[model samples]
Target: MFMRKNQIKCVSKAVLVIIILLFSNELLAQNQRVNSKSNNYFWDNVQFGGGIGLGFGSGYTDISLTPSAIYNFNEYVSLGLGAQYSYVSQKNYYNSHLYGGSLIALFNPIREIQLSAELEELRVNINPNDPSLTSEQFWNTGLFLGAGYRTANVTIGVRYNILQDDNKNVYSDAFMPFVRVYF
Candidate 1:
């Protein structure tokens, strides 16, 4: 148990160091670009994005959608909210659904880098194999923190879920990667 804790600490420290180094580089670039970019109207600072996916197979099908919008309060900070929905069905026995919302705060030191934290609340329903059983709703909360790099309008990042439960949740891991496209 002690060893696991130490490993976690090490991993956390490594991630922090990487973020710091990248952020500092971005700050330097930002300082150089500050004079070239114009500060537009508030409406111009709004961004919209989302992701959707679908999968189908002989025994299963899955679908998910997430939509979000963010308003940049300044060059350094932004706020956003989004909704998530997902459905999974197995040919005969398994069925599940998830729906939720999330709020995030982001700090951008430059155009290509952002540090963010999010809080999400979701309700999930899983049906048992037995047809007689009723579907039960399980409420879950996920708090995630991470950093992302942007290329044009797309951002890619790795996130760690702080409240994931292997036995009671649909997510497979505490760590996951994300991609977002903005308009």
Candidate 2:
């Protein structure tokens, strides 16, 4: 009877271990599916796009065409580079090449709508012939708030510049409407 009881206890323990392991594996699989679903909903890869825009503020008016590209490391974070050519009435109407990277964070409360905050640096060079200045190089830092809508592979957005400093003169706040294509 003593040997039989010992054998029964060992079998029971083995069965209990097997059940525990099975349950644990099932839980792990469920967690993996949930994780994958969440990752799929979030944008965690590189994105590229470009658009044209116009800026009018204070005593300055500009028509610009810009081409830009970005690498989004995750759903909430991205870095980008862009160049712009602008014709300004207040200045000598020279074209400026701008290269800057922006760090942006996105908040999406719904499937189609997203809000973002970005900090960027814009480098500008003034026309040498402008009587108001001899030679000027502008390094402007701008803070922007934007909202976007996504449809298929395209995103349409509007942004407001809350801060801008051109080193020589500061201009009034401005707004930009843009579109981006994702691949």
Candidate 3:
């Protein structure tokens, strides 16, 4: 029998991440020639992955897309850059869109756990219905530090926003979750 629509969608998303990781891993296994006589450099060691998130509350909806690429300096160290786009809609409340980029670092003492850090800069725009309050746009910055676990292809973790904005931003919560799929 056919599964429900939402179930089918979830299955497809899972398959997509797995397929991406498997395909990239196959390419990574190649030791083919980079030149006539030269070997590949450190830049040859790279992986790509990121998380997708969606949320619903009593009167609001949140959807986001985050993609990232990481380059390995060694087994224990790597650097990455990623982008985030999110839209929030609420009944009787303002609607907003958030766009941001993050610089990420990961250090793994072992194969299973990693220490992480990110510096993010975000621009948020909100449109309110009230005539007294004008539509607003502002930039906010956050520095986050946390740890996570990594398996063969997926990572799940939580982070605390160490530098939270007090007056002009909506992400006042100090903690958040992160997921990634390594390609």
- On lDDT, the leading prediction is 1
Give model 2's TM-score versus the native structure.
0.52
The alpha-carbon deviation from the true structure for residue 172 of candidate 1, after best TM-score superposition, in angstroms, is 1.4
Off by over 4 Å in 3: 1-44
Please give the distance, in angstroms, between residue 148's alpha carbon in candidate 3 and its true position after superposition. Answer: 1.2
Local distance difference test values of all predictions, in order: 0.88, 0.67, 0.85
- Candidate 2: 10-residue stretch with minimal lDDT: 164-173
lDDT string, candidate 3, 64-183, tens digits? 998989998899999999999999988777889999999999899999998899999989999886667889899888988978999987778899888886676568687988776878
What TM-score would you give candidate 1 relative to the actual structure? 0.72
Question: What digit string (tens of lDDT, one per residue) describes model 1 on residues 55-85?
Answer: 9999999999999999988878989999999
Q: Better model by lDDT, 2 or 3?
A: 3
Give the TM-score ranking, best first: 3, 1, 2
lDDT of 1: 0.88
Question: All candidates: CA RMSD in angstroms?
Answer: 22.8, 8.3, 20.8
